[model samples]
Target: MVLVEDALLLAASAFIVTSFVGLFRVVRGPTMPDRVIAINVVGSNVVIVIALLAAAVGEPGALDIALVYALLNFLLSVAISKFTVERGGVL
Candidate 1:
């Protein structure tokens, strides 16, 4: 069980580290959609990491927080996409 927990921690850390690579796209993406996708990826990855950490730490509250974060990320992504489409990518 300990080994499994440790593996989960390592996996979560690995996910977070790789998510940083998406930052390049967010910062210097050739187009607006590319940047939006990158940001969405980072947000999803963060939710995964948070859930994993919650499991590793045996904290139900952390999982709740992760769920809320996921919801917010999803809503924000949709809102941004809609705004981009409606405003020709101005906002």
Candidate 2:
């Protein structure tokens, strides 16, 4: 059980690092779609980290929060994509 918790922590750390990389992309992306993709990547990484934390801490509520966060992320991505398209990529 200790090993499992340790592994989850490590995985979460990796995901956080990945999210930082995605953050850089979001900041430096040359195009709107690229920034959107970066945002999705970061959001998914955040969800993964939250799920891992829930497992590591034995918190059921965190899992539920993570699920809700995932849904919001998806919806936000879709909305941004639609807005960008409608705006003719001005975003």
Candidate 3:
């Protein structure tokens, strides 16, 4: 199982790289919506990485937390969208 662990670790590292890229884009974005989109992308990657870590480490309830984080991400996006529309501004 060492090989499998190594592969998973590699996958996790790639995901982290993507997450950081997304974060950088968000920080340097030219528009509010662009930043929001980056945040959403980062949230999704975080969810996937969390789930993978849960599997790799055999951690109980890690998946549950990931799911919760995923749900929160969805809600945040929706709320931001609504607020933007209501305010006639980018969010």
> Best by TM-score, which number?
2
Name the 10 consecutive residues with the lowest summed lDDT in model 1: 82-91
lDDT of 2 by residue, 1-91 (tens): 9999999999999999999999999999999999999999999999999999999999989998999999999999999999999999964
How many clashing pairs does model 1 include?
Answer: 0
Model 1, 90: alpha-carbon shift in Å? 10
**Could you tell me which 10 consecutive residues in candidate 3 have the lowest summed lDDT?**
82-91
Cα deviation of 86, candidate 3, in Å: 1.8
- Model 1: CA > 4 A from native: none
lDDT of 3 at 79: 89
TM-score of each: 0.92, 0.96, 0.91
Number of the top candidate by lDDT? Answer: 2
- Regions of model 3 farther than 4 Å from truth: none
| Residue 49, candidate 1: C-alpha displacement in angstroms | 0.3
* Ranking of all predicted structures according to lDDT, beginning with the best and ending with the worst: 2, 1, 3
> Where does candidate 2 stray beyond 4 Å?
none
Error of 1 at 19 (Å): 1.4
**How do the residues 1-91 of candidate 3 rate in per-residue lDDT, one tens digit apiece?**
8788778778988999999999999899888788779999999999989988887888969999999999999999888878877888853
